[model samples]
Target: MGAPRRATLRFTSIAIGVALAIVASPAAAFCRSTTCTGDCPRDADGCKTTGKQLFWPGVCVGVSLQRDGSVNIPIADVRSVVATSFATWSALDCGGAAATISFSQLADVSCHQTEFNTSAPNANIILFQDTQWHYKGVDNTLAKTTVTFDAKTGEILDADIELNHAYNELTVSDTTVVVDLQSVLTHEIGHFIGLDHSPDPDATMFAGYDDGSTNLRTLEADDIAAACAVYPPTRSGKCEPAPRNGLGDACGASAPTTSGGETSGCAIAAAPSNTANRLLSLLGLGLALRVRRRDRFRS
Candidate 1:
């Protein structure tokens, strides 16, 4: 074959190879729906499944106590929980408005006991025979609680504190402090949101609790990505531009700023066309193939 014909054939072969690889990749497949259970490795199907629960998109706004002696959990902690939990969703491409905990406004807060109360009869209790407490007695016990919120508004109307007094029964070691607070909070926060027990023991959202260990601190990419998807920042960040009526600001323009006695506005522009050049090159390969086929028929 002539050099020109050989080059054309090579180009066509390369284009076909590139297109096939793109279509065959895993990302081309739509994710399957499957629930993750205790200790199971994330799979394409199981990882993609999400709960039907809908959360309101707004910052966690308030935390305060009621007239009663019961402690009111801070909305800031609730905000942190939402931030950490929805982190998974944001990493994924799933579309939704991001949820936030707003501290801007004060709101009424209340608490109720849901489990393991020492005051109640027949309550399961863990007694520490020794007076030795770890980390100023804070690490001595592991307590868990759930505070439910209104669907429309991310308000904490009630909380249930579950305490494992036996936490005090364990001997204090160097690893205990690091593991106790991080693991427990990560787990309880999982429940605070809509996630149920994950069958994967290694997962931070796992159902059963383990002793002092740092394994749960790092969230699985799937979990965080899923949470982010539920509360996407894109939809959450958009706000209607303030009306120009009686205001000196320009309509549909960014906030004005005075620098060196000069006004400036900020705007975004589209990126330059690198992909367009690549597409044109690919099309040229197709044209070369057609020309070669026509020459072969003429011969």
Candidate 2:
């Protein structure tokens, strides 16, 4: 086998958004995340239009909340909020039928590291960075969602959410909140499921977030439309939520260990892409197959 390699991209740019009144139908303005970046000149709303639309090619996807929630919030509270935030999307009404997509919350994982293991089992993790914010613009950026996907088919392989609790106050209450945790998760969840920032300001997938505002806790018309469109009721697939090879809570090749300490050789074929307050880029790694990383930033 070839030696493993790593590639890192520096994200220090700012993506500023100015909220504007919508002149078009709000339901018609939702944006889908593509394999291309924001610079791609395809979507007229400055969303994505030029590349393959990113999506999970299955009916069910698995999600794992890090066992260590956050230093400022209780683990139970974090679990509850995370569950509710994802549930909100799973139960979307697509014209009397449920959307084709569903999520299975695998047991809380001990792995807090954000990565896609090419030669071992993996988990789609949602973790809080309470000790340090490792990205640029620590003060204004609230969170980031990193999606690992197949560039050729636009199929999502693994996704992870990192909350910037180290630099900002994240609250759970409905009133007098500093930064509502549910709102942040819900918006990030959109990115997790392959939705981009919508042109409509009222959408839960909007690019800009208002502090202390819980408006993103619920989906708007645009969000609903986007969900139904992406995962229509007639979409054909089974509800298998296990991550690529299987779910492993640890951070490396030795994950899901037994007495024999065996590991699988299954690697997800990919190319790198990103998204952030909201950074999204596509990264290319030197691996056997092309692996892409996608990320989105929240402010």
Candidate 3:
């Protein structure tokens, strides 16, 4: 029998990516929301854990990229952002025999939607949505990641990410009021790679987000530990850094920018919230601003 499915979490610019355990829940709990549920996989001894560490077949993974970018930025820069964001985790020095993370581009896809198909070659895709933004509650969300895992063993089957471009102007420029596309993707990639939220507010996996911050673009200490714990260097497997099809970053016949050819732009959009400082102090607001785990899926 096929494994059951769990709920998913979506991403946003202002507030994005609350950590989750991919727990089996009723249909009512499956509806994504903006409130933190404080749910995570835990040991019977009470230690926190992810729903499960991802088990990559033969320790290799292939990802598909949408060949297009939102009107706010060029396609080249979008691919660069993805590469940079992914490299942060791939190049980590996990002491020794670590489960090194690596990525290679699949054929660039024309379809920017997020889904998995059993009848066809399913893709682990990351794409941008520039025309329409849809989700429950507020429309300020920046992106969302859908992770499909085995309901029985909690083993991840496939994952996809979608970026919201219609309401927000995204950019790769380091100096700009607009949101940093790389920063947002870095966080979602955490979810994409099977990480849940961290209790440390300063950690990148924390549910709270600080706009205009660049620290998240790189993996923090906590982020590294979570990955290392799952794919430790001593784990039993060979690490291969090549893609299934080829050793290039071309989406289909269209090639993407080289690692050095990163693009840049300004997404002059939302103003920093006046109360951003208060929200940053998640515990200061008492019950109103509780540091709860927010659900980001829609019914």
Q: TM-score of each candidate?
A: 0.36, 0.76, 0.66
**lDDT of candidate 3 over 134-210, digit per residue (tens):** 64212355667666654444445566677777766667888873667887778777766666544434455555444
lDDT for predicted candidate 3 compared with the true structure: 0.50
Please, what is the whole-model Cα lDDT of each candidate in the order they appear?
0.30, 0.66, 0.50
Query: How do the residues 1-299 of candidate 1 rate in per-residue lDDT, one tens digit apiece?
Result: 11121223543454345345547431221121122222334332223243224232343322221212212223344334334433433234433433332222122223222221112111111112123223212332344433333323332222222333332322223354422333444554444333433323234553333343444445654344334433445544322111112111111133322111211110001111221100000011223133324433432
The best candidate by lDDT is 2
Question: Lowest lDDT 10-mer window, candidate 2?
Answer: 261-270
Per-residue CA lDDT of model 2 for 182-275, tens digit only, reads 9888888888888876645556775555555677788988898888888988888878898877888888675332222111111111121222
Candidate 3 Cα errors over 4 Å, as ranges: 1-58, 238-272, 277-299
Q: Which segments of candidate 2 are over 4 A away from where they belong? A: 1-26, 254-299
Q: Which stretches of model 1 miss by more than 4 angstroms? A: 1-57, 61-143, 147-161, 166-174, 177-179, 235-299
